[model samples]
Target: MTTTTTFDELPSLVGTDLGYTEYVTVTQDRVNLFAEAANDGQWIHTDPERAASGPFGGAIAHGFLTLSLTIPFWTELLEVEGVTAKVNYGLDKVRFINPVRVGSRIRMTATIASVEEVKGGLQINVDQTVEIEGQERPALISRGIHRFYA
Candidate 1:
């Protein structure tokens, strides 16, 4: 479920666990597209046949590709009302903890770690974990910094 709130309501969200997003499958085609877009067609991420014999035993999504999915997963978790713009200010301590193999499903759970008033808007610090289906460890984890502008 999405946690929808106005800019005024942001301050109250500190320490709120926003819950998880719906799962998204990582497909070979999606990996290919991301490889093309990122100009990082590494064998393990783009060449399935060759990768099948490589470590992880199959094509895997690029780390950045997995990280990029954070945006959509985040949107599914929270929505800030009355913001003219949203900026992906940055991330801290981002770690690709596990491989997202092609055809694997993944989802994210988020928490609002903090909410601080920034220059002209609000800065939301979120703790995020992207989990691969049926996996013990998460695929990725990070502290995502976002800004909502008036």
Candidate 2:
């Protein structure tokens, strides 16, 4: 279940399973764009002709591209009200469990693992898993930490 809560209710959100986001297809064009923007034009991520013979069989997305989708997926999972700013503090224990091939779809399921009071704000820790569509093993897992300033 997606959650929308106020800053005042943040404390109660700890340990809640915030549910999954809509599936997003990983496309070759998207991967190529990311590679161009990141200056990481690795054949495995940008050159489909070359990558077709590589291990993954075709170009795959950069791990960081998948990681960057965390924010959009998080938005689908939760929305915090009455916050002037919500900051992405940092991530913890990030792991790319599987390579996301172009044309594959992925989604995320998240849990609010912990919450703590911080100066002028609240610190929230969320455990997130990005699951590949129709696959048993997830594509990625990480702890996303954020600060919501009142």
Clashing pairs in 1: none
What TM-score does candidate 2 get on C-alpha atoms?
0.97
Tens-digit lDDT string for candidate 1 (111-141): 9999999999999999999999999999999
lDDT of 1 at 146: 98
- Model 1 regions lying over 4 Å from their true place: none
lDDT of each: 0.95, 0.94
10 residues in a row with least lDDT, candidate 2 = 1-10
List model 2 lDDT by residue over 1-150, tens digit each: 568899999999889999889999999889988898999999999888999999999888999999999989998999999999999999999999999989999999999999999999999999999999988899999999999999
Error of 2 at 60 (Å): 0.8
TM-score for each prediction?
0.97, 0.97
